[model samples]
Target: MKLATYNVNGVNGRLDVLLRWLDEASPDVVCLQELKTPDARFPLKEIEKAGYGAVWQGQKSWNGVAILGRGRKPILTRRSLPGDPDDLHSRYIEAAVEGMVIGCLYLPNGNPSPGPKFDYKLEWFERLARHAAELLALDVPVVLAGDYNVIPTALDVYKPERWAEDALFRTEVRDAYKQIVDQGWTDAIRRLNPDARIYTFWDYVRNAYGRDAGLRLDHLLLSPSVAGRLRSAGVDRHVRGWQHTSDHAPVWVELSDD
Candidate 1:
C-alpha cells in the first residue's frame, strides 16, 4: 500500500495542484494538512470526482486536517486531539482505512519563540505525546503522518546554526519530538533512507527551492506492526516546483501487505 501526507497550505487555492498530484501519484491513502478552509467549503465533490473519498476537519484561514482513501471512504475515528477541551483548532484528524489507523496532523508553527505561542506549541507537543503513547499501547498497525512543523535534527535543516534559535529547531521542540519517537515509533523516511539529506519543505523567499535550501518538516511515523511492512519512502520534490504550489511537498511510504 502507498500512503502519503501533504500540507496543501490552502485546499481551495491549490486544488488544481492537489488533483494533478493525486492523478500522478495515485497513493492508496493520503493525509492532508493546512486546508485553511472551513468545513462547509471542503470541496468534497471535486475530491470525490478525483476517485477518492475523504473526511476532513477544517478551520477558516488557518489550520485543518483530512484523510483520503482511494476508492473507499475513510471511516471517521477522531476529529481533535484529546488533551485539551477548549483547544478547538482543526489540526488533528484520524481515520480507519485499508485495515490500519491513520492519524493526520498539522502541528503549530510557533514562530518568534520565547513567547506564549512557543509555550502553546510545547504544551501541544506534550498532549500529542500522551495521546501517541495511548496509540502505541493499542499495538495496531498505524501511521501518523503530517506536517510536524518541527525540524527534528540538525541534518533536517539546510543551515543548523541559522535556525538554532527558531521555534521549529529549538532544543525544547526537538526534545519533544524525540520523546514521541522514543515510544517505539519508526520514522519511516529516515528508516529507509538513513543518511540521505532528504527535505520536504522549502520557503518561497530567497529562491530557497532553486538553491536547494529545504527542511524535512513533514514526517510519517509507523507503529511496530506497520513499520515491519515499510518497503520504501520518499518525497515528491518536483511537486514543490509546480505553479502556485505549497511550500511543502508530498512525503510518502510504501508498505507491504504482509
Candidate 2:
C-alpha cells in the first residue's frame, strides 16, 4: 500500500495540478493540507471523478486538510486537534483507511518569531504531543503524516543557521518533534534514506527550486506496527517543477501488507 501527503496550497486554484498528480501517482491513500477553501466549496465532485473518496476539514482563505482513499472512503475519526475547544483552524484530521489510522495535520506556521503566533504554535505543539501520546497508547497501527511545519534537524534543512530564528526551525519546535519521535514512532523517509538530503518543500522565491534549496517540513511518522511495514519512501520532487504547482511536493511511504 502507498500513502502520500501533500500541502495543496489551494485546492480550488490548483485542482488541475492535483488531478493530474492523482492520475500519475495513484497512491492508495493521500492526505492533503492547505486547501485554502471553505467546506462548502471543496470540489467534492471533481475529486470523486478522479476515482477517490475524500473527507475534508476546510476553512475560508486559509488552512484546510483532507484524506483521500482510492476506491474507498476513509472512516472519519477526528476533525480537529482534541485539546482546545475554541481552536477552529482546519489543520488536523484523522481517519481509518487501508487498515491503518492516519493523522493528517497542517501544523501552524508561526512566523515572525517571539510573538503571539509563535506562542500559539508552541501551544498547538503541546496539544498535539498530549494527543499523540494517547494515540501511541492505542497500540494500533497508525501513521501520522503531513506538513508538520517543523524542520526536524540540520539534515532536513538546506541552511540550518539561516533558519535558527525561524519558528519552523526553532529549537523548541525541533524539540517538540523529537519528543513525538521519542514516543517510538519511526520517521519513515529519514529511516529509509538515512544518508540522503531529502526535502519536500521549497519556497517559491529566490530560485530555491533551481538551486535545490529546500526543507523537509512534511513527514510520515509510523507507529511500531506500521513502521515494520514501511518498504519505501521518497519525495515527489519533480512535481514541484510543474506549472501552477504548490511549493510543497508530495512525500510518500510504501508499506507491505502485514
Candidate 3:
C-alpha cells in the first residue's frame, strides 16, 4: 500500500492543491497535518468526493491532524494524545486503516529557545515517546507519521551552522527525536536512502525551494513488522513548487502487502 503524510498548512485554503495531489498520487492511506480548521469546517464533503474517507481532529487557525483511507473508512482509534487532558491542541489523531494502526501528528514548532514554548515542545515529545512505547508493546503494524517540526540532524537541514540556535535544530530537540526512534521504530526514508540529502519541507521565503534550502521535518516511522514491508519511499518534491502550495511536500512509503 502507498501510505503518505502531508502537512497541508491550511486545509481549506489549500484544498485545491490537496485534491490535485490526491488525484495524482492516489495513496491508499494518508496522514495529514496542519489542517488549521475547526472540526465543523473540516470539508468532509469535498474529501469524500475525492474518494477517501477520513477521520480528523481540527482546531481553528492552528494545529490539526487527520487520516484518510482510500475507498474505506478509517476506524477511529484515538483523537488526542494520552499524556495531557488540559493540553487541548489538535496535534494528534490515530486510526486503523488497511490493517495498520496509523498515528498522525503535528508536533509543536517550538521557536525562540529558552522559553515556555520550547519547554512545551520537549514535554510534548516526551509524552509522545511514552505513548509510542505503549504502541510498540502491542507489536502491531504501526506507522507514526507527520510533520515532526524537527530537523533531526545536521544532515537534515541545508545549513547546520545557521540553524544552530533555532529550536528545530537545537541539540535537545534532536536528542528527543533520537530517543523515540531508538524505541524500535525505523525511520523509513533514512533507512532506504541513508546518504542522500533528501528534504520534505522548504520555507516559502527567499526562494528557498529554488536554492534547495530545505529540511526533512516530515517523517513516517514504521514499526519492526511493518519496516520489513517497506518497499520504497520518496518525497513529492515538485509539488512544493506549485503555486500557493504549502511549505511541506508529501512524504510517502510503499509497503508490500502482508
Candidate 4:
C-alpha cells in the first residue's frame, strides 16, 4: 500500500491543486493537514468524487486534519490528543484504514520562540509521546504521518544556521522529535534517502521555493511492524510549483501488503 501525507495549507484555496495531485499520485491512503475549513464546509462531495473517502477534524480558518482512502471509509479512532480535555485545536485525527492505524497531525508551529506558543508545542509533544507509547504497546501496524512542524536534524533543513532561532528548527523541537523516534518508530523518508537533502516545505517569503530553500517538516513515522514493509519513499516536489499551491509538497512511502 502507498501512504502519503500533505499539508494542503487550505482545502478551499487549494482544492484544484489537491485534486490534481490525488489523481496523479493515486496513493492508497493520504493524511492531510491545514484544511483551514469548518466541518460543515469541508467539500466532502468534491473529495468523494475524486474516488476517496475521508474522516476529518476541522475548525474555522485554522488547523485541521483528515485521512482519505480509496475504498472503505476509515474508522475514526481518536479525535483529540487524549491528555488535554480542554485543548480544541483540530490538530490530530487518528483512523483505521485497511489494517493500519494512521495518525494525521498538524503539530503547532510555535513561532516567535521563547513564548507561550513554544511551551504549548513542547507540552503537546509530551502528550503525543504518551499516546504513541500506548499505540506501540498494542503492537498493531501504525503510521504517524503529517506536518510535524519540526526539522529533525541539520540535514533536514537548508541553511541550518539560518533556522537555528526558529521554532521549527530549534534544538528543543528537534529533541522532542528525537525522543519519539527513539521509541523504535522508523522515519521512512530518512530510512530510504538518508543522505538526500529532501524537503517537503518551503516558506513563501524570501523566494524560498525559487531558491530551493526548504525544510523536511512533513513526515511518516512507522511502527516496527509496519516499518518492515517499507519499500520506497520520496517527495512530490513538483507539486509545490503548481499555481496557488501550498508551501508544502506531498511526502509519501510505499509498503508491501500485510
Candidate 5:
C-alpha cells in the first residue's frame, strides 16, 4: 500500500489540481493539510468522485487537515490533538485504514521568531511529543504524516545560514522533532535516501519552484513495526510545477502488504 501526505495549501481553491494529481498518483491513502476552508465548503463530492472517501477537519481561510482512503472509508479516530481542548486551530485529524492508524497534522508555521507565535509553536510541539509517545506505547502500527513545518537539520533546507533565525529551523523546533523520532518512529524519506537533498515545499514567492529551491517540510514517520514494512519512499516533485498547484508537493511511502 502507498501512503502519502500533501499540504494542499487550499483544498477549495486548488480542487482541480488535487483531483488531477489523485487520478495520476493514486495513493492508497493520503493525509492532506492546509485545506484552508470550512467543513461545509470541503468539496466532498469532488473528492468522492475521484475515488477517495475522506474524514476532514476544516477551518476558514487557514489550517485544516484530512485523511482519505482509496476505495474505502477512513474510520475516524480523533479530530483534534490531545491536551489542547482550548486550542481551536483545525490542524489535526486521525483515522484507521487498512489496519493501521494514520495521524495527519499541520504543525504551526510560527513565523517571526522571538515572539508569541513562536512560543505557541513550541508549546504545540511539546503536546505533539507527548501524544506521539502515547501512540508509540500502543505498539500498533501508525503512520504520522503531514507538514511538520520544521527543518530538522541544515540538510533539509537549501540555505541553512539564511534560515537560522526562522522558526522552522530553530534549534528548539528541531530538537522537539528529534525527541519524537527518538521515541522509535522512523523517518521514512530520510531512511530511504540518506545522502540526498530531498525536499517537499517551495516558497510561492521568488520563483522557488522553478529554481528547485525548496524545503523538506512534509514527512511520513512510521512506527517501528510499520517501518519494517517500508518498501520505498519519495516525493512527487514534478507535481509542484502544475498550474495552481500547492507550494508543497506530495511525499509518499510504499509498504509491503501485511
Candidate 6:
C-alpha cells in the first residue's frame, strides 16, 4: 500500500493543488493535517468525489487532522489523543485502513520557546509516547504519520546551529522523538534512505524553497509488522513550489501488501 502524509495548511485555500496531487499520487491512504476548518465546513463531498473516504477531527482556524482511505471508509478510532481531557486542539485522529491502524497528527508548533508553549509541547510529547506505547502493544500493523513539528536531527534541518533556539529543533523535542523510536518504531523515510538530505517542509519566507532550505519535520513511523513491508519512501518536493502551496510538501512511503 502507498501511504502519504501532508500538512495542507488550509484545506479551503489549497483545495485545487491538493486535489491535483491526490489524483496524481493516488496513494491508498493519506493522513492530512492543518485543515484549519470546522468539521461542518470540511468539504466532505468534494473529497468523496475524489474517490477517498475520510474520518476527520476539525476545529475552527487551527490544528485539524484526518485520514483518507481509497475505496474504503476509514473507521474513526479516536478524535482526540488520550490523557488530556481539556486539550481542545484538533491535533490527532486515528483510523483503521486496510488492516493498519493509522494515526494522523499535527503536533504543536511551540514557537518562541522557553515558555508555556514549549512546556506544553513537551507535555504533549509525553502523552503521545504513552498512546504510542499502547498501540505498540497491539502488535498489529500500525502507521503514525504526520507533521510532528520536530526536526529529529541536525541533518534534518538546513542550519542546525541557527535553529538551536527554535522549538522545532530544540534538544528536548529531539529527545522525545528519540524515545518514541527507541520503543521499537521505525522511522520509515530515514530507514529507507539514511545519510541523504530529504526534507518535507520549507519556509515561505526567505525564498527557502528556491534555495532548498528546508526541514524534515513530517514523517511516517511504522510498527515492526508494517516496517517489515516498507518498500520505498520519498518527499514530493516539487509540490512545495506549486501555486498557493503550503509550506509543507507531501511525504510518502510504499509497503508490500499485508
Off by over 4 Å in 6: none
**Each candidate's TM vs. the true structure?**
0.99, 0.99, 0.99, 0.99, 0.99, 0.99
- Stretches of model 3 off by over 4 angstroms after superposition: none
Clashing pairs in 1: none
Model 5 has an lDDT value of 0.95
Instruction: Name the 10 consecutive residues with the lowest summed lDDT in model 5.
Output: 206-215
Predicted candidate 1 versus true structure: per-residue lDDT over 1-258, tens digit per residue: 999999999999999999999999999999999999999999999999999999999999999999999999999999999989999999999999978999999999888899998999999999999989999999888889999999998889999999989999999999999999999999998998888899999999999999999999999999999999999999999999999999999999999996
Go through the candidates in order and give each one's C-alpha lDDT.
0.95, 0.95, 0.95, 0.95, 0.95, 0.93
lDDT of 3 by residue, 107-144 (tens): 99899897999999999999999999999999899999
List clashing residue pairs in candidate 5. Answer: none
Q: Of 4 and 6, which scores higher on lDDT?
A: 4
Candidate 4: the clashing residue pairs are none
lDDT of 4 by residue, 79-158 (tens): 97889999999999999999889999999999989899999999999999999999999999999999999999999988
Candidate closer to the true structure by lDDT (higher is better), 1 or 6: 1
Cα deviation of 233 in candidate 6 (Å)?
0.4
